[model samples]
Target: MSRTVTLALVDSAGTPLGALPSFGVPEPWWQEVGSIVDGARRRYGVEVSVLRLLTADRAAPPGGCVSYLAEVGAPPRVPLAPVTVDLAPQPRRAPWAQPGGPARSLAWAKRELDRLGRPVTGVNQQRSWNLSAIWRLDGPQGSAWLKQVPAFFRHEAAVLRWLATATPDLAPTLLAADDTGRILLDHIPGDDRYAADQAERAAIAADQHTVQRRAIGDADALVAAGVPDLRGPTLARWIRDRLAGHDTSVVADLLADLDARMDRVRACGLPDTLVHGDLHPGNVRGDGRSRTIIDWGDAFVGHPAFDILELTEGLDEIDTAPLVAAWAARWRAERPDSDPERAVDLLRPVAALRLAAVYAMFLANIEPSEHPYHRDDVPACLERAAGLA
Candidate 1:
């Protein structure tokens, strides 16, 4: 006998999109929904679709409530009547509420939205309260993207606001921000791209460098004013620190080589700049004509070379040399007196450090235990950083 599990997708109005059915008899069938859909599509030649459903575990306010059901599953073969439940109307908590309630964030977003005269539309409770809402008005001042900010999300919003103000022509316009860090900004249309061609890639890198150079001056002033530096330690120090805990002879030899290269890196001495912190192709947007950077959570004060490193991560090694050369040429053109060769040399370690740090962060947060890339690539990154030393 065939066994199946059913799921539903409901919107903010509590309306059901449809019921999804999965054919399986496993402990956690919900987790394998994607695989099941793919298998079904391949085996039966049927198009499968999935929708995000928001259902609360307990009747409570939107913020404090949990999305007991928000997943992708197989659509039911037969239509079923929509089921409605009389859920209690409790005070909504901010979606970003953790083990301890962050009531301040809720008050902040609400107050700001009220000032803008807009209602919260769609919200994703996972990975913090990520709300994508719209505020509509008449004329040119119509439509804004409202986002709720948890403590961790403040950096991203701050970076976006900074870019919007400093490089208005290059970034989205900020409408308003509140004490709780909730933000309302002008929305730009276009999807982030992963695969960019040579010229287009060079152009985006140029724009990023321009913004970094401009922001760095301000960042240095912030440092001078006694603001604690958020940029992490230098690439050399980071490699040594990670190596202290690592257990591998290959890594040890690589670290020795990296130690020797420290002088070379110091001699290069690339100037500090306001780095985007994460500048991979995935975070970059636009056709060769114009580019937009999304997700600025990693913004920090660091070497411009470090930003280049982040951009080239996961790409094949064969492409690194030419890309680095192109980037250095652009940097020199912008700052005519600067030595492009020295800057390019500095990028090697900067790249290593950024890659290692990011891989460590990803292993800590995103990857599963059985993922081989985490087990292997992370150590490989450390070794590469050591080699750069």
Candidate 2:
């Protein structure tokens, strides 16, 4: 599938230039802007950085033809006429969505890297959106990552620090972090293990179980570390409130049974602990021997089963069973009294509710243009929950 992007070029001063012809690229994923940037550089012979999405055409959630208002780092060296187009300021803005936000983030990363004596030699913006802005910074030593998250996720730095202290190897090495949610991390040298074998998947699941086990009785400490308390009751309230305004008439019966199902999940005896809210194979990075989990923006304190559900999300029943068994075995060994198998069964609908609430939260906070990224997520998850009911 091919995806295209139309750029409304803007100078560093936020002055509108002209619109570039809509360019097509093989990679159709809309949110991943690395290809879009590379395409602009390759075809137009100009360096451009995407600031935020302006409007999407034929966009189906994650991919399609989209128009973005981008900042031009330098004038185009090649003589290619860009059509005259009016560039108006976007009414809705996230901090990183603002024209100056990317520059400021880059400045802070450079300053911090300089302080660490690892001045940047090159930069590559891998992703930019409302949730986070990520850049790969290269220096004499190696590549490091500079990630700036929104205010809602300002707690990520603290969460990483807590993880470092408690379970050192599970998270990335934090080089430097500030109050603005910008974090400099030492790059883990490996491809994301999205295609790990069944044995490897089992092993990774066990490792996360260990991490969650360490946080078993430290709910207050985890909260103090800036992790949100999405324990049973808290998440329940969020689900109810999130689904309140939406027309959930079709799932009305399922919604009514939500509380009882959640209570059964609680009764399964799995203690609430640090849940890796978006735990999946794609988020794990390693070179066969060692593995590390990345992206803690969705981390929360919730039932341990939620992590298992996340880990085995897209797997078939045969493949998912072994991973879940390995994860549950560790927990059952740790808490001999707990019934993890039962918890996994009971938490299916609850997990769906959690996903719905989270996507709803994303839609509420992000700019309108970016809303398409998660617009259908709430209803899709609710429908899944109803089906699972």
What root-mean-square deviation over C-alphas does model 2 reach?
2.0
Residue-by-residue lDDT tens digits, candidate 2, 166-226:
8988889999999888999999988899888888788778888878888888878888878
| Position 230, candidate 1: lDDT | 43
- Highest-scoring model, TM-score: 2
| Model 2 ranges off by over 4 Å | 74-92
lDDT of 1 by residue, 62-83 (tens): 2222222222233334553364
- lDDT score, candidate 2: 0.81
Candidate closest to the true structure, highest lDDT = 2
C-alpha lDDT of residue 139 in model 1: 26
